[model samples]
Target: MHLAFLRDYHEALVIALARTRPTIERGTVAEITSLTPQAVSKVLTRLLDDGVIATAGVRRAALGKPAAVYRLVPESRWAIGAHVTRRALRLVLTDLAGTVHASATTALPADFTPDDLLGRLDSGVTAMIREHRLDDDGPRPLIGVGIGMVGPLDQATGTVRDAHRLRHWHDIPLAELAGQRLGRPVLVDKDVTAAVTAEAWRRDAGFRDAALIMVESGVGAGLWLNGAAHRGTHTNAGEFGHTVIQLDGPACACGRRGCLEAVHDRAADPAAAAAILGVGVVNLLQTLDLGHIVLAGADLLRHGEIYRQVVEDAVRTQVPRADWLTAEVTLTGLGTDVIAAGAAIQVLNLRYGLPDPVGLRLP
Candidate 1:
């Protein structure tokens, strides 16, 4: 590895620690990151000088010299995340620590077009910036914008290859278009991927090998494996809704018959729908051997407890040797804000979080 890249990784690791840990010090950070004391000292000094972190006073040890504690200066930078749902656009402004400081939502037109979305995005983002008084020239400037939209889209090129159920979205260059309109750097990703990223950020190292199942306008699963968001070969991984569950089932928007989403959506009641969802989740667990399953999305949250119970029951009863193949299931604590907040956190991750270890194998 290049020395410069290694230095960048060390800095990102330290920043990640400061974001998640309540208190940070040289000894603990070095211990956790496996960086030598001297390297840790250099990283800390640089971060401190850059105003990304600040001293939180001192921690005294009876045997050794008192070590200075540090904490992330969350307000030093900010990013806006937008969740582009079928009915509305949900926006959240988050800080470097990934804490959502403010949120807003605006309704979209029926079967909205790229122009429609771009217009709304421009007005909405401008309003947010003005309302929050987030001066571009201020000490704490807004970093960028991130959009979490329904997908089967291309994350690598920031283009929508073909967003299921939305006609105008095909072949749209969302990231570039939004960036041009908003006058800020932009990132576009599947909504489920964004939601899972938010959960991973919140859970820290404990979030390894997990999936975030979302059920709003449709069903999809966001995958986080080996400590990172798994955006498969085409960067279009989270199309969990279209997975075939029934051979003679109803037709789906993706031109598939008996897809999980189609079957679940046709169910009579919330309980029935949830039960259908549970089966798919168990299938996911069986395939991935996931340790955590987080449930989110507005439609699902309306009957959150019912879905949670159904999914938990499925996990307990369906998978073989349930005792050994246990998976914790729960609703996303962020409620409807999960995807939007995750979008903003994605921007933070790009700017100040850990570098992706793409080809490295993990234990």
Candidate 2:
């Protein structure tokens, strides 16, 4: 119960801070949350005492008493993020202020098994910890970990249900294996989902409800809402690649004709701007009602203009809903390295705590 309540209160505090930027009066926080002024005062006091927030100065209304304002301390704790792909793995340790502290990567064989991947992950974590100069011993009581990997992921089971990029891979035990080995809570998300998570956490444009679409080696999308990934009933909500976009477009490996994946084949179609892309984007955007679109992943970037033009053109023509027009589309901030940054950031988060300036307390 304490844990649950702490999490809820933490979220409430985080939401309030995010919406208002750095500094806010206790009264203002109360007004935004519709909570009693006294309650807000208590939370603020705790935040200040714990160093999560700090008092800045006195604010004076035209004819009122001076006000004490609180702001996110700017640096509190930090997080590690990791992104895993068929060819390589990337990791980064970040400070609470969205600053990258350390980073590294290693090549991954296309035929590696789940066990093989986990072994590399263990080695990577140990190396990252050492590189980060984590305390005299190591990190303890970490925040959380977020992982980005090739999907169809079973979030509940922490398994990769089926990944085409890796040879003979299905139902790979990723979450359980990593969590057990690392001794920290692990969050499993598809590459796009983890990218969205990182994007939201690091940027002002992050959606209260949003979607991230990656057209890389494999086309996949990730869904995030209310500051967390919406893994859905079956935890397979964003498998848009499997949805049929063009009934007779092309044959998919799933033994289907015209699935989004087949239509958006990055390698075969040098020109990714064919009619098939329009159908997929239009169908996906309308159904998701997402307010923003982050176009990322390596394959799409490789094609560059071809990829963007197809998506933008499709969105313009297919989306009849006026509200959908406002959905902002932008290239990922980190571009092709987003997954790697996201992955490394996830590990850092586990070591430090999301946005906690205290990061891993490297010796």
Candidate 3:
């Protein structure tokens, strides 16, 4: 086994425990990680030396020697997340503990290009750094940037693959461009996916299988399946709006007939729109059997209660055996800031999150 891999895995495990619990002792970490006390001691020493965790004095007991306690240093690192929508760009600064410290939003010109977004981001990030007085030379330094945008984009390659209704975004290497402009690492993901990540981060363990249904300028679903963001093989899975609802009903922006978005967009009123969206939600429930459905996005949130009730009622009545297979429907707790905050959380997760067990190589 590579010593580096062991170190990272152990460090991530301890950091995760420290974030949730009030304090962590070497023995408790050993018990949880199944690592020997000696191994846990080595990991703790490294984490303390790196300033990722801090000694929280000692916990004395009636038993053996007093064990040293440790806690996550939330401000030990920072990240900036940006939510790019058709109308505006929202940014948030988050600490290692995934707390949003500050946020700001800027308007975007209609049909903006890749360059347009990069300019706004460059200025906005510079302003945020200055405003917050985040020290680059400090023990806790700014990490990198994460961008969540409307998609049909490739998260792996950070390429925008023709975002519906946005003409200038065709096959743009946004992550590379933005990274060059901002002079920092960048991560790009679907807006809804990022929003769902934020929801998962804030909620407890029960939020494993869920979907964040967003209806801003368009409709999309962010899937959290089996405790992770379920980006499809192509990283374009959350194109919920384009799912055909009515065969030969109406033409859609993706050049399809009878899309859910087209019908909802053409609805006579918010009630009718909510009804259309409710049908889509039921379809998703039947397919995924999700435990939670979160409604978000500016357009949907304008009539948040109406949409929430419609989805909740649909899940209650439309799904067979609804009484037994209950699905919780609610609005996003973070409101409009969900995507940006989630993007920031992604950056934090890159550094401190646990390694995927499925991907880990066993000797």
Return the top candidate by TM-score. 1
In terms of lDDT, the poorest run of 10 residues in model 2 is 354-363
Backbone-clash count (model 2): 27
Q: Estimate each model's TM-score.
A: 0.96, 0.82, 0.90
116: Cα error in model 3, Å: 1.4
- After superposing candidate 2 on the true structure, give the runs of residues whose Cα lies further than 4 Å from its correct spot: 2-7, 15-20, 97-99, 135-141, 203-206, 225-228, 266-271, 274-276, 303-306, 321-325, 340-363
- The collision pairs in model 3 are none
State the displacement of the C-alpha of residue 314, model 3, in Å, after optimal TM-score superposition: 1.6
Task: Kindly indicate the candidate among 1 and 3 with the higher lDDT.
Answer: 1
Determine the backbone clash count of candidate 1. 0
Worst 10 residues of 1 by lDDT: 354-363
lDDT of 3 by residue, 1-363 (tens): 698877898888788788777799988889988999999998899988888889889999999999888988888889899999988899999888778889999999999988889999999999998887776667658877899998888888889998878999899988889988987779888899888988887675678899999999989999988887888778778899999999989999889999999999999998889999999999999999999999999899999999999889888999999998899999998888889998988777777776642221110
Segments of candidate 1 deviating more than 4 angstroms: 358-363
Rank ordering of all candidates by lDDT, starting from the highest:
1, 3, 2
lDDT string, candidate 1, 1-363, tens digits: 699888888999998888788989999998999999999999999998888999999988998899999998988888899999888898999888778899999999988999999999899889999888887758868888899998878888789888777878889988889888887778888899989989988777888999999999899999999998899888888888889999999999888899999999999999999999999999999999999999999999999999999999999999999999999999998999999999988887776767754421110
- Arranged by TM-score with the best first, the candidates are 1, 3, 2
